[model samples]
Target: MRPLPGLAAASVLLWGCGPAAPRMAATPVPEASATAGVSSALRPTAGASAEPEPIPAGRASPPERYDDGVDVLHYDIELALPRGSGWMQGHAALDLRLDRAVTAVDLDFSGLHIDEVTVDSGPVEWHHEDGLLSIPLGSPAEAGARHRIAVAYRGVPDDGLILGETVHGDPSAFVDNWPNRTRFWLPSVDHPSDKATARFTVHAPAEWDVIANGRAAGPPVPTPPEVPGPSVGERRTWIYETAVDHPTYTLVVGGADMVIDTVGLAACGEAPVSPRADGCVAVTTWLFPDSRAEGASSFRRAADMVDVFTDMIGPFPYEKLANVQSATRFGGMENSSAIFYSQQAIAAGRDIESTVSHEIAHQWFGDSVTEADWSELWLSEGFATYFGAVYFERVDGMESFRERLAGAARAYLTSADTLRPVIDRRGDLFDMLNRNSYQKGGWVLHMLRREVGDDAFFAAIRAYYARYRDATATTDDLRAVFEEVADRDLARFFGQWLRAPGYPVLSVSTRDLRTGLRVEIEQVQGDYAPRFHIPVDVEVTWDGRSVRATVPLEGAGGVWIVPGAPADARVTLDPDGWLLHRLHGSPPSP
Candidate 1:
């Protein structure tokens, strides 16, 4: 994580001082019936007609291929902790993946306290707590495609997720933050980069309700007497199955006493459908009863966003998508099928449309289509950030679009912690994914829009989604699509922004003239490289009217002359703020 020149230097200065972090905004569900094209196509400048093509259901395209990967455990957790009574008990079925065999199977155990352990219905050796568990079998867990494992553990989960310790103490530490700590409470890959499908049969006190990923199969039924755990008291169960082509890390489950809303998502040709061979998919959401005062809401917009994304990228890859509102540590988190948003969002009287839309957007980028590593997080986060802005542009206008881009630029530039490269391999995962991944990531997209001339850029993005939907992708894969669509080599462009650190700073000077203006701009490359390309905007005012001209810095600095410098001068570097670079200039002339 070598620092980049510009903000990277600033980042170093505040290395241990808790670098400022950006708010990970809430992801909202999109309304139904909108077109499935990138919002860029909907721009007025594109002369886009209101009429859009419709996507058919059931003709599902295959998601990008992946290895069968592996599954270590299948948990059927039944716990009752809400009433401060009852016990936590569940049967675990574990399957181990072995490239070669000869040893034990290890399972994560930071939260659950193992009470009983058995393999093949026989007692086995095991350990508990502190995130390490080794279970031995009668024979070495052989190098086979799969091996079976089972364990039963019960304990109370801390009220919140466990984040790095703060001065207050461990219990007060932030939970459910980025890079995810909740997974430690349960067993899973624990990182977004290693997603796997899991099923849950969770039991909670009947007085308190439940909400989780996947579709709920049925109401709470009495646990069968044959089951080893106690079936005492009124208990509820939730069933969440992973969607096809969904990223493993996006899988999520949370429950509380709340009012649940169910919507039958019908397959209108205009709305997106699940990859499953069903004409229509049923969608449901649960919101806290306290927050329902806003207004009557429907899933039409969410369906439309899904439709648009499916047509542009591929069909929605999962079995189900749920946008649930709850008290979460962050603005929103893209849990595989279920998205958990802050309860304050719906309570604070905020426009929740964009929030739902953004989180759903992650279903495609961060959830379904995941970045290969944390370093390329911008590929996941940047896509979502731009998607929100594009959604805003469609609902509003170009002014809104400009405002969003400008805000991103300002936020990225002023933030002292933004010097990190947009693509980073190692560091604090949370810090790396903050402003640099979001705001600067938006700027990278803005630059893409400018470079690809809108049509090619949007077309390329749609094509990229279609190519990589519901699968893993890397930065190189993304650039390939752009190169194909724009019909040019973008290696240099990506290199300077994604790989290299820091942006260029410009020094501009000009001489007054009766006939024209003489301008000289000198560029300095901070610590990275001296060679870079930038667009410089200069405006000259005569009387009350002003004329503007733009010059591109192909090398370090250059000179240009403009006709008739009469009254005032204003100079800007990358006036549109297309790149994540900075500018320095002489005082304006009058």
Candidate 2:
């Protein structure tokens, strides 16, 4: 889904929406650094089977609009796509948990030309209106009661499931329901807050490959006469089911004529069919055979990247990870286990690590550890951006990682329209994808790492990921985890960085004493911006030797005394680019 400005998945040559935006040229990655303190993330005892701890509830109340009477638990959908007519037929069955007594259920729906509705295997009264469908249950279900609602519909979803032609001119169909477009095809509570397990039985021409969110539920099973299945053509129904619950936005379907690359990740597990298996993950890549060489070149490092991230985080979190090369509204869409990439990103001999890594990172951040509300978009975008930078730091040098953050900081500072906090409350969906959510968000995490040493930072990351995995989290939820790990309140730290609008601007003046140097750093921000509490790394040079150490600076201004050998000693502030603020006095610093 689009953050603020609408972001494509990832890439240097590829910004957010692939082919939608062009950015800087691509940079090659170096080999990963030797494992140091972060290896604890991959503790052998902490496998994928390690149960996720219950995440603490957010301090804020759940948004009223999202607290619908019915909570969707599972979805079983059957859809049939015919050749030219843009029209389609479908039947959706939803297992729901009732939160309150209700004679009617409301679901977000745009256009489906519904035919009928059924509840408890019987006919029910229903009405379709502007952006919603009201289904009368006839009898109100009591709180805590479980019920099933089914809807049969036939119409065209020309705006939802994106259909186009690939380079080989093959008909390609991919899901692009970022923000809120799922309603165009499925009749259900289409909010991210309403998560559910899903099973899809898609009917298309036998020649086209059908893929969905979960693992393949065996070969094409014959349509059953026990229910209303796709009868649009002589089609075989391919069924897929998810073992883990997921937001509707991450639900995906990719159908096309393409080649496949299968690589087994024998560490994560198999599809829930054999719930007792070794939990191995299957990695499959889909691309047109004509472009197979280039696609192969672009995905050569897929396995390596998986190993790197798994080592840095916990075990891989899905039954399988499918990398599909397709025509998308975005360069990449992290649709749970299946990640769709733009056909345009495929270049001979060059792997699109930026996009791939970002999407894979989402398997941990966005997909599993989802944001509670759209306002906490940084938890998804920022986490992906920074983790991508961290991946670059591992594979590329520290300079490359610094360049990425500096570029993000520059983009954030230079943007004239950026004034909102990183935890933006704007109702507009596209407003969540701006530089503040992406680049500067990365800087926030980067600086946080500097604040808490690397060991604690990575541990906190794994802790947060594992704790919130398969659940929704807020910015407050994340800050709580970090604070607990860092053993500090961090109220001021997160407040000034996330709630405040801009970064700090400092002006420094140094005084040379007979024995050492006294340095005064001033916050030059006129108003509106906050004076950050940051640890400024200072360097003191005197008579051919230099000493470096971090000096804690708090509030509007502060002074630090440097123990030195002479008064003529030169003093420097922030010798390394550890903080995301501007310096403007005495010796220049980055």
Candidate 3:
């Protein structure tokens, strides 16, 4: 999720509803209500005209646990998109295994009206209310038991699936299910923990071209006339399926009359054995026909980014990659195999390389190696943010990387979320998208890289990705991998950066001594800030020559003596931008 610049401050107000309340059982849908247009629960009730109060900041909370009794293995979804109306027909088949013996199964679903539900081709008693669909099993099923459940429904979605016109005023439909909004259109366990393979069969207007997750099963086929739906000229059916499982947030489908250009096959740092080689992934760009030139220019390096990250991390986790210009709410959405960028940005011809790299990096961290809990989102957003800078370092040089880190430090210092810890357990999940999770999170990784040598750092990164690929992880999971590779206790290092609310604020002064120049450092960030154990790099300059030394500053403060230094020596702190701290009084001398 690449938030548009300056959009974080407004996100809470825009998406004030936050994650939906926990699901609860409701009365069964009466047979007469099967044909209802939309669930009454979704519509605004009486006295709803008043303007709602703003959602307080730092008020969102994540679920206590992730598991929801059933583990979904696959979702076979078929949706018939209407040509003019907002309502659409949907049929979903879920193949799942029970984690524990249960008398009923609950699925996260809302807005849509259910026509029927069946378990193993038999109709079962079910209830739908408060965004949850509960199906009674009639008997307790033992753990490990597998079943295929099917749901038939239809309605106008309230969110997740955005049905509207594109920037070019052409009809378009795109799925934008970040956080936990998938329940608005699709019925399943809408949590990141229960990742599952998916097959999307979409029926849309014949003129539109559809793109979805994974490789297309085949070319577009004409919708049969016998199929039941509103008559809207010729309709085409698009089928796509993912061989690998991923979180629900990343699953998406986009449809529009657009131009798609194939950049080339991106190989994993080597020439492919053949055109269809296993080591290579095809890279393409989808854009509105009017902005073809701008889109092509912006996404010209799509394949190169794939190659760089593949070599740096492990392998590309998906079959192919598509950078699409769509009507996404975010500036850039890292949707598994297909990434969606803000249509406005591309139409205006802005240089979106940084945003593109950020989203592409998420294909590895946020998409493949997901964070199990929202509180540990730094494992996803932070990794992507830092690795985006690393991409520049590999191509542009170390100086460019240092500049990027300095910019991140500035952003963190200026952000309103400066007083919050990166792993904030409280607050609206949207608030987690602040500097604490992104800029500071990247700083944490940068500081860790400095602590551990480049060799061990990159080695641990590869190991962690290989271990958690196609799965979920937490900050501790990452710490374990780094500790194993570096062979050191990193508890203090991670705690101070991730758990602590604020960074080290230091006041430094230098004086002349008979033995050498004396440098005194004091931590004055108040009581809330942790007493950081920092390795400070001090450079003392005099008479055309300079001496550099690493001084270990712990607890409140420390004193380091530079022997044989002149009385009028000039001092500079963190000359290479290696630490995240603020200095009081005068700035470091140039």
Candidate 4:
């Protein structure tokens, strides 16, 4: 992945590197009522009344989308990796269509040493500088034209692809490109906004197995290339093809002593037969040979996860699924058909099942229909995190799911003071991978599902996936889909949660009056501009009877008449986890 120009390139520190804590952070059950959407209403704290200024255009620029005059059709990349040198030579053939007349084509490329460049099988004037490769077309290419730029280059990518060594001196490597790290390795329009179908022909030493983004098109064919002197070792070339259109970030290459195997799709659960799709979807695993047994055991129910998500959305969108235990910086990266997991987390076997589920969820959200820009990354990361919980509930019980949601809420709330909105674009690209994107993003989805009924929510998800499969989308795109399915205007609902900073902190007060229980809800968030227009539920309990009712709580504050309750009743705000916030009660305010 390519970091924005001048921005430092850094990978997410793995759980292994961070403080030793539970992979999923969830504190013990705290004060229950106060934890859910209620906080200190009158606490002395500074508040900003003005709306957070919309992210400035040049503050955090979205990645370049140069699809105006030319658009990439497909990429056939032939990569040759010589063992031990950490260097790779590549020959890339980029098929493109000219949408309009173009005198030049700009491609994102960095680090690689270019040997030769051609346009439509002929020599072309080319310039490579500061990560952008500019190729002049001699004269303006006609509109609706077709051309292919073939490039021969070689270099060692320091960032996107890393050669990591295990404690036992086993040479291992993985590609860890999130946000915009693809340009540090492969060349093309590296932004998620410009995606293309890809084919990979990879060469690695015979001892190390090669893994790419897609399923293997055929068996590994040996290619004994002529070297200048004595060759280092026996090398082989593997062919893989992914017809699915995905962002460059999903393209990956890893070589390790990993054992690959297949498990039945029925293992995930009852596999749903896609009407237009044929064949039983196969679940595959790539793990280090030493830990093959435990790694395979850890990923046992991956097939079930596939079925669970497919049943929830639509059919499995990719060719097949491969869970690779790699040396990736992230705990797990959902790279199209091939998902890479950190070896450290895999060895521990903690949260392995849920991690696998998370990556598989991305096959639909992140890989098939990608986020149009980094600002909308929650559409990918958050969806994966939420669906992982869904799978957790399916495999475990409701308690586990509740625990997961509670964990996410806790993580988000703890970071609330320093939190940015889900659709933030003002900071570095890496900032998009924060608690907001993973946990809070999931909470937003959970709340949306609660806002619309389960039927409508699922329908919206299926429709969204069906409409955008093999394409790219944005936060507005998803909001529109949800509104269309639910048939309700959800602009405020999305805006307050997605664009607003911090979260709703409600101060609750209830009186058991004769005319039902009088309940008051107030929004006391750190920011005053966002008065969350959300559905609130007031739960009342007295004399072994409990009742829950929806009350109007759309902004600063609102008084509600809770029916079917005695005057003297204990009221709990949002008893069923519909709203994500901290709740606190006031002592009648003097």
Give the winner by lDDT: 3
Question: How far in Å is the alpha carbon of 396 misplaced in model 1?
Answer: 1.0
Kindly indicate the candidate among 1 and 4 with the higher TM-score: 4
My TM-score estimates for the predictions, one after another, are 0.74, 0.83, 0.88, 0.84
- Local distance difference test values of all predictions, in order: 0.55, 0.70, 0.79, 0.72
What tens digits encode model 4's per-residue C-alpha lDDT throughout 521-572?
8888665447778788888788898877787776768787777567778888
Off by over 4 Å in 3: 6-65, 268-278, 586-590
Model 1 lDDT tens row, 411-491:
766765445678875544556656778877767877888877888988988777778765678889989999999999999
Better of 1 and 4 by lDDT: 4
lDDT of 2 by residue, 4-70 (tens): 1232344323322223212212221122232221111001111112111221111122367667788
Model 1 poorest ten-residue lDDT run: 38-47
* TM-score, prediction 1: 0.74
- Which model is ahead, 3 or 4, in terms of TM-score? 3
Question: Of models 1 and 2, which has the larger lDDT?
Answer: 2
- 1 or 3: which has the higher lDDT? 3
